[model samples]
Target chain A: MAFATKRLGKELTKLHGSLPPGIELVSAEGFEEWLLDIKVLDANPLYLNQTYRLKFKFSPSYPIEPPEVTFVNTKDRPIPMHPHIYSNGIICLDLLGSQGWTPIQNVESICMSLQSMLTGNTKNERPEGDQLFVANNRRRPRDIDFYYHDNTV
Target chain B: MVNAEQPPDPVRALEFKEKGNKCFQAGDYQGAEGFYTQAISHDPTNPLLYTNRAMALLKLSHYESVISDSLTALSLHPNNMKAHFQLAQAQIALHHEKDALESAKKAYELCMEEVMHGGKGATSLGPIMELVRRCRKEVWEGRERERTRTEKGLLGELVRDLEDRRDVEVQRLEGESAGEIQIEEVRQEYEGKIESLRGVFHRAGEVPRRRVPDWCIDDITFAVMDDPVVTKTGQSYDRSSIMEHLKRSPTDPLTREPLHVSDLRPNLALREACEEFLEENGWAVDW
Candidate 1:
C-alpha cells in the first residue's frame, strides 16, 4: 500500500512528458486524483470535435484496486453519449470495475480504452435507464453489478 | 544526483526547466515543483534545478521538502549560494537552528566573496548578514537545549542502573539470609538423628560404661585398649591382649596362624587416626 504513491508518482512523471494520442492530462496535483481530457480520433458523428473530461480518483490500494473513474462535465467539456455512460457521468465500463482492472492498466491505458470506446461507438444514447439510475444509485461505480453483454464496445 | 540512474539529456532537461520557470512565474508552485522534479530526473547533475524546486516548495510551505531539495542542490554544487540561503530559510522555519546557522554562514561567506570579487556590491550582503546573525543566536540556544536533553537522558540511565544494582544487592542479601537459616535447620535435623541413634545404642546393652569407640577395643579382650599392635596376620590387637594370648600358646586370633610375641608390631598410624577420630567424636565413644 505504501508503494501506491510511488507507483502513481512514476505514472505521473511518465505522463508529464507525453501522453497517448487523443488523451491529454489536464492536471495531476497529487496521488489522490487526476483530471484528463480525451478525444476520439475517428470521425464518429456522435463524438467528433468533442473532448470529454475524465476524473480519476485513486485509493491507497490503487493499481491493486481499480481507480474510480467517471466523466466530469465542465463548461468546455461535455459528457459523451454512450450506452455504457450514464447521463450523470457514471460510466458502466467493465474495465473500470474491480473485476476487469489489472495492475498493468495505467492512466494512459485507461484513457486509450475510453478513446477507443468513443471512436467505435455509433449509438447516440446514454446507458439503459440512465435517468432512473442517476436519481437513485448511491453506490460507487465499482460497487455496481454491471452485466457485460456487449463486449464488442 | 540521486535520480541520475537514467542517462542525462541536457537539452530536454533545459526545456523542462523553462516550463518550470514559467509555471513558477504564473504562481503555480505545485506545477512548478512537478516540472522541476522532471528536470532533475532528466539531468540530476544540474544543481540549479534542485534549487528552483526548493524555491517552489518553499512558496508552497513545504518546508521539509524545501530543506531536502536545497541540501541535494548544495551537495551537487557546494558553491551554489542560493541553495545554501534557501536551506537556511527552510531550516529556520523547521526550527533546526543549529543546521540553519551553518547554511546561513556559508551563504554569507559566498556573498562576501562575490562582492570582494566585484560580482556584487556590499549593499546586497545586508540581508544575508542579518540572517547569519539571527541564525548564530538561535544555534547557540539550540545547542544548549540539546545539551540539556542529553544530560537528562544520561541522568535517567544512571538512575536506572543504580536501581538495578540496588535490586541485585537486596536479592543477594535475602538469598544469603535464607541460606543461613536452611543450614541451621539441617544441622538441628542431623542432631536429632544422632540423639536417636544414641538411645538405640543404650537399649542394645553394648554401650561401654567408659566413653570409648568400638574400633579402640582389643578383639581378643573385647575392651578398649590403651596400646594397639598388629600381628603378623595384619590384625591389630591390644599389646597386653596379644601378649597374654601368646603366653597361652596362641595362634593369631583372627588369622589362626602361628605367631610369637615378636611378630606383633606397633601400628602407630592407625593409633593416630583412632586418636583423631575419638577427639572429634567424643560422644560416639560412649555409643
Candidate 2:
C-alpha cells in the first residue's frame, strides 16, 4: 500500500502533461485527495455548458481498492441531474465500486468514464429515493451498498 | 608565529557545517562541497563533515571522491548509516556491485537496529530499504552477466573443438578415393553444429538497446516485476503486489472474480525474461 503514493505520483505527472477533452485537473496538492473539473463536451441539454467538480479521495490501498469519488457543490457549480446521481453528489457508476475497480484504472480514466456517464444520460432527475438517501444515509459512498440494478445509464 | 598543528576549532566547524547545509538545501552542490571541505578542515576528526562532503560529491557525480569521503566517514563513525548508504551509492555508480550490496546491507541493518531501539532516524528505514533493493538488483545483474560470459566462453570452446576434430578427420582422409566428398560432409556437419550452438547462445550477444518492455512491468505496481505470478484469468502481476491485494480482498484485480492466493501459479518463463532484461537494463528496477 505504500507504493500507492508512487503510482499516484506517476498518474499526477501524466495528468500534468495531457488529459482527455472536457477534463481538467483542479488541484492535487497531495496523494490523499485530488480535485478535477469535468464538463460534458456534447451539447446534452441536461448538462449543457455546466461544469462539475469531482473529488477523488484515495486510501492507502488505492488502485487495488477504488478511490472514493463524488461531486462537490460550489456556488457556481451544480451537481448534474441524472437518475443514477443523487443531489448529494454521490455517483452510482459501477466503475467506482469495489467490485468493478481494477488497478489499471487511473485518475484520468475515471474522469473520462464520469464524463461519458454524464454525456450518455437523458433523464433530468435524480435517483427515485434521492432525498431519503441523502438525508438518512450517513455511510460513505464506498460503505453504502447501493443496489446497482439500473444499467440503462 | 603560525603553528601548523592547531587544535580543531569546533565553533568554526559548526558555522561551516551550517553553511554547507544551507547550500545543500539550496541545490548548490558545488557550494555545499566547498563549505563542507572548509568544515572538515576546521574539524578534521568530525565524521559528519566527511559524510556531508560525500553527499555533495555524490550530487556532483564525482563518484570516486564520494567513495573516498564516505570511506573516511565510515572509518571515523562506524555506525553511521548515512556513510554506509552513501558508500553504496558511490560503489554502484562505479559498478562495484558486490561492495555496493555489502554497504547497502550494512545500512539496512543499522536502520533496522535504530528502529528497534526507537531512535529518531527510524523514518530513514524506507530509503535504506530502497537502496538495499537497488544494490541487490545490481549484484544479481552482475552475476547474470558473469554467467552469460562463462556460457559464451564454453560454447566458443566447444565450437573450436568441433572445428579441430573436423580438420583432423579431413587430414586423415586426404588423397583417399572419396576424400573430397567426405571432407565436404565433415565440414557441413561441423558448421551445422556450430550454427546451432550459436543459436543457443544468441541472446548473450545482445546489447541493451531499449527501455523496459511492457511484458516485464506489473500493472499493479506499474514497476518492473521481480517475481511475476499468473492468476486464473491468465493476467500476470508482481507476486508481492498480488499477494498484498489478496490479503485485503480475495479477488482477481482485473477480472473481479473470486480468486484465492492458492490459484496463483508462478510465471517462471516470464520471470526469466524479466531477469534477462533487468540483467542488461538494470535501471528498469526503478522504472
Candidate 3:
C-alpha cells in the first residue's frame, strides 16, 4: 500500500483549482510537507500592502489530524495580526491543534481555512499585549476567559 | 553488466505515500497508519516515511507507537527535523510537555540552521507555522492540563498492567494451592486499583469546562454530535461512539486496520448536516 505523502501531493495538485491566486503551494519535501506562498491581496491598513509566505507539514494523518503549519518569511515580510496570532507567527487558533483538530480535515480544507483566517482579519490587533507577551504566556484563544466579541480576523 | 545508480522504484513507494495521505485526509488515521507502515516497508530508508507514520499514529492517538516510530526515524537521520517534529508530536500526545517543547525547539533550531547553510529550511511555512503555534500553545501552556491528565492516564495503565500480572500470578498460585481461596483476595487487590484508576479519569472532567481531555480526539466531534447509533457487535458503532473508541485506540474491530473517523461515512443527510454546521460555525471547511 502507498503512504500518505503521495496521496497528499495528489490531493494538493487537485486543489490547484480551488486555491487562492496568491497562495500557491510550492514543492513539498520530506522535511516540509506543505509549502504555501501567500500573496496578500488586500493590504492591511496598519502594515500597508505586504505579502508573506506560509508553510505546512502534515503528519501521516492529514485530514483526520491537523497539519503542522508555520510562517517562514522573515520579519521584513510582516505577518498579519489577529487575536490568536503571535508576533512570531504562532497561531493560537483552536482549529489546528488537538483542542480543535478533527479527523475530517485535509490540506485543501486547512488552506481554505487559513485563507479565511487571514482574509477575515482586519483589526491588525496582535494577541492581547503583544509587546510584552511571550509565545507561551499568551492565553490560547480557546482558553481565554474573555467572551469572543469581535468577528474580525 | 548493467550500470547501477538508478533511483529505486519510488513509484510504488510514492503511491503508498499517496494512499496513506488519502486515508489521512479521509480521517481514517488507522487506515492511513497501515498504509504508512506499508509504505515504509516498501521504502524503509525514507525518513519521511517514519515521520508520516508517526503522525498517523498520533492522529490515531497511539502515542506509544508514535514515539517508537519517531525515535526510529531520528536514529536513522539525526539531523532530520521532521523526525524531531514527529517525536515532539508523540511526546505531546503522551503529555510529555517538557519533552515535546524541547523536541519542537530542537526541530525549529535545526530547520533554521539547515536553511542558514543553504539547506532546505521551511520552504513551506504555511502548515509548519500553524503547527509551531499549535505546539507552542498546546504543549507549552497546555502543560498543566496535560500533566493532570497524564497522571491519571499513567495510573490507569499501571493498574491495568498490575491486574494482568496478578491474573497470571494468581492462576499459577491457584494451580499450586489446589483451589485455595487466596486467589480471590489477590484478584480483588488488582481489581481495586483498576477501579480507582478509572475513578480518577471519571473525576478529571468534573470541573466546568475543564481542559480538554487528552483521551478525547477533537477531530471526530462532528460525527459524534451528528449521528450516534450503537452497534450490536462492535462491528461499527454509530459514527460518533465508534470514532471515540477508535480514538482510544485504532484496532480494527474486524481486521484491526487501525480505523479512523474517515473509514466510515454518514448518510447524505448527516454529511449535509456536517457541511452546514461547518459553514454556520465558520470552521475552515474544505473537500
Fnat, 2 decimals, each candidate: 0.00, 0.58, 0.15
Top candidate (TM-score) = 2
Task: Chain A only: list TM-scores of all candidates.
Answer: 0.96, 0.97, 0.70
lDDT by residue (A92-141, candidate 2, tens digit) is: 98878876777778888889999999889888899989999999988899
Pick by lDDT: which candidate is best? 2
Off by over 4 Å in 3: A1-3, A16-18, A43-48, A131-153, B1-287
Q: Which stretches in model 1 have alpha-carbon errors above 4 Å?
A: B1-287
Tell me the lDDT of candidate 3.
Answer: 0.59
User: Tens-digit lDDT track for model 3 on A1-115?
Assistant: 1224534644654566466566676766663366766654556454346566666766554444556666665655666666766676666665676545544455656666766
Model 2 achieves a DockQ score of: 0.40
Count of clashing pairs, candidate 2:
0
Query: What value does the lDDT take at residue B163 in candidate 2?
Result: 88
Q: Model 1, residue B172: what's the lDDT?
A: 68
lDDT of 1 by residue, B183-277 (tens): 55555654565566556544653434644455675554343343478876677875544654555444665554677766777888876766565
Considering TM-score, which of the candidate structures 1 and 2 is the better prediction for this target?
Answer: 2
Over 4 Å off in model 2, which ranges? A5-66, A69-153, B1-3, B177-179, B195-287
* Candidate 1: residue B187 Cα off by (Å): 99
